[model samples]
Target: MIYIVLSIFCSVTVAMLLKLAKRYQISIIQAVTINYLTVIVLSLLFFKPDFKVINSSAPWPIYIVLSVLLPTIFLFLAASVKHLGIVKTDIAQRLSLFIPILAAYFIFKEDFNQLKFIGLGIAFLAIILTFLRKTEAQSKSNKWLYPIMVFIGFGVIDILFKQIALHKELPYTTSLFVVFCLSFLVSIIIVATMVIRKKTKIQLVNVGCGLILGVFNFGNILFYLKAHKALASNPSTVFASMNLGVIVVGTLIGIIVFKEKLSKLNYLGIALAVCAVILITLSQLNAV
Candidate 1:
């Protein structure tokens, strides 16, 4: 439980910091690059995961897919943030959870019951509710298409994570390191493309901010990896819980810390997310 909560906190903090970075006038690409590098260093120096588990033939797809996928996902997410505000963009992205749960059921042979079904429905409703806009600006800007594309990408990433965790014998940290390492390489290509197009430059601010985010981001991944390992049979549940927990914490931060308001439906959406996690976890595992 502590693991799940801490992971959620890290995830939320990452967002809040990124939001803060915008005020600092940092480029999103540079910020992302810095964040990933910081995570890579911490992973190498502190975690010391045994990466050999991912070396075998079995780990190939998980290793290869995430290696290529995440850099693109991060960029797409940044774009989504730019086009859409943080709340709607993220709430829209919650759709990413669907694939992993469905994939687990079919590919991993995970099982559940009616109660779980009810819970999932409720949680999803909550997420949608949270993004239910109060202002004309937010309502007019909610583009379903962009976020749908991003959702598919993130969904695939989660499937890969589930596969790597269940089949690969490597320390979860090792798989993460490999994933981040690949994310780094791919991100470089992305950065080069941006440079070639003369879209942006990596100012020192970007580097500095990226470093801080990277450390926290790496820790976020590590913490979630350890938690999933503990609840390996139903890691999708933990993933859902962690994100939903972020929503719970994020909403509070939005309200208390940021003085963000919640309409009637938004509060309902938060409730839905929480309910769905309970259903998803309990039904999926029958363990909670």
Candidate 2:
């Protein structure tokens, strides 16, 4: 339970850091690039993944896809937080579980129950309602594209991660390290290009910010994995708590600290999103 709480805190803190990035004049690309590098160093020290298992038979295609998508979507996450605020951004991200759930039904042909369908319906509605702005000016200037992309990008990334997990030949940690290495390489290329073009300059503040982001980002993953391990018998508990926890924490921080405003419909949407998660959890438990 403590692990779950820590994971939730770290997840939301990532958003908080991104939200503060613009005010601090931190380069998203530079910070993100260093973030991946930080993760690489941490993975090496902690996981110590065996490289021998990573042979030609490994899932390079999925690894390559995730390598590109991870950093790209990370940039979009910053944009979404900047425009849409933490409340809507976090809800959209958490609700992205629906994407893989849909894939399970349509692509993987997994059994789908009525409760799951109902949850999906409400989740979609919640997404619509949560994104609604109060005024005309706010609506017009709202960067809806960024949050929308975050939703879809994260969903696709989830699918890809699941695919990599299915490849049993490679241990999950090793596969993770490989993917991180590739992602770091990709981030470096982008950062290098921007530097060469004189579009951005490397700065110590960005590096410092990136290192902190990396710790929390990696902490989120580490603790979530630990929670799952600790509660191995109750996978749904982890799923429900993780999704719901982030939404609840992110909402509080967004509203109280950041002073992000929401309409009545937005509140309604948030309520529905919570309901959707509970319904989805119940459906999964029933399935099991």
Candidate 3:
């Protein structure tokens, strides 16, 4: 339980840093790349995850998916930050339980209770209500398409992650390293293009933030990997609990500290979001 709580804390902290990175003039893609780079370096130094497994004859598609996931994540997350604001984007991203839940149902054929499905329904509605704004111009409605696209993109990522988990041939750490390398290379290409086009400058502070993001991001992965291995009862429950906590804590901080505007509907939506996790866990109590 402590591990679960701490994982949520780390995720929320990362979200806050991503939100604050704007003041440092760092964009979201740069922040994500920096964050992943940080984790890769840490993985290199402290973790020493089994990297040699890549040479094994596991399967090529897994590596392909791993590579694709990196760039998709970087781009999807950046789009989310741009279109939805940090808080809503985080909610939408974390609230992507639908993808995994459904995937789990079809792929692993995991048993699902009625209440968990009901809770998923409510969580979906909750996300919609929270991002409402008074005027069209003041709201993220202008760039809403990006967030929706980001949602679909990340949903695929989470689903693929589950597939990766179920793969007997692929270990998690090797998968992580592979995905990070691919993402890093993609980021370099992006940065190089920007440099050639003179679109954005990669500043010293951006690199520093990337370093910070890397630490937290790596820690995020490392801790979750443990939790995944430790809690054998219900992985979905853990995923739901950790991510929902992120939404609650992150949304509170966004409102209290950053003065994020929310309508009555939005607050109600937030409440519903919280209830979704509770209900899902309750539905899974039999398994746990």
Candidate 4:
């Protein structure tokens, strides 16, 4: 329970940090790059993952892909929060659970009971409602592309993490460390290219923001995996709690702190998101 709470806090803190970054006019890419560096250092110091266990037969492909995808999706997440605001971006990210659930049914050939199907249905409706705008002008200006990319990108990242979690040859922490190393390398290359192209200048403030982001981002993953380990037999509990907590908390912060406006339908969509999470959780419980 403490792990779950900590994970949720870390998740919201990441969102809040990104929101603050936008306000401070911080360079998102540079901050993300530095954040990856911080993640690498913290992961190594904390996990002390053994590198020798990695071999040709190891899951290097997943590691490499996740290395790229994690930072890429992080950029998308920043863009989503910048463009779509925290309320919609948070919901879109949480909704990514559908991707792994669908993958389980189709690729893993897992059973999908009636409750699961019903839950998926509600989830789909919730997404539609969440994206619905009150006016055409607002809809046009607020491009849906950023949040849409965030949804798909995070879903794919979740699927990759699931694969890593299933691999028994390596400790999850080691795999995470390897992925972070690769992600940091990738970020270094991107930053270098940007420097060459004179696209942006690196600043101390961006590094500072990145350091903070790295702590919260790493904490979010660390505690989330801890919660899963603590509740190994109750993954659905972690999933539902984390997602629902982020949505509720992110919505409040966006509306109250940021003063972001949401229409009645958006409010309803938030309500439906809670319902969808409940139904999906019930499905998992029933299966158990």
Task: Name model 4 segments beyond 4 Å from true.
Answer: none
Off by over 4 Å in 3: 105-111, 136-140, 233-237
lDDT of 2 by residue, 1-288 (tens): 999999999999999999999899999999999898999999899889998998889988899999999999999999999877999999989999989999999999999899999999999999999998888887887499888888999999999989988988878878888998999999999999999999999999999999999999889988998899999999999999999999999999999999999999999999999999999999999999
Clashes by residue pair, model 4: none
lDDT of 3 at 165: 65
TM, every model: 0.82, 0.98, 0.87, 0.96
Considering TM-score, where higher is better, how would the candidates rank from best to worst?
Answer: 2, 4, 3, 1
For model 1, residues 105-198, the per-residue Cα lDDT tens digits are 6887866578766765775676567666778876776464555567688888878886776754566667778778878887878888898899
**Model with the higher TM-score, candidate 2 or 3:** 2
Question: On residues 135-154, what C-alpha lDDT tens digit does candidate 4 reach at each position?
Answer: 88877864788888888998
Clashing pairs in 2: none
Clashes per candidate, residues 3 or more apart or on different chains:
8, 0, 3, 0
| Candidate 1 global TM-score | 0.82
* Candidate 1 segments whose C-alpha is farther than 4 A from its true place: 51-58, 79-95, 106-109, 134-151, 226-241, 285-288
Candidate 2 local lDDT, residue 79? 96
Give the Cα-based TM-score of candidate 4 against the true structure.
Answer: 0.96
- Scanning candidate 1 in windows of ten residues, the lowest lDDT window is 81-90
Q: Residue 212 in candidate 3 has what lDDT?
A: 83
Query: Order of candidates by lDDT, top first?
Result: 2, 4, 3, 1
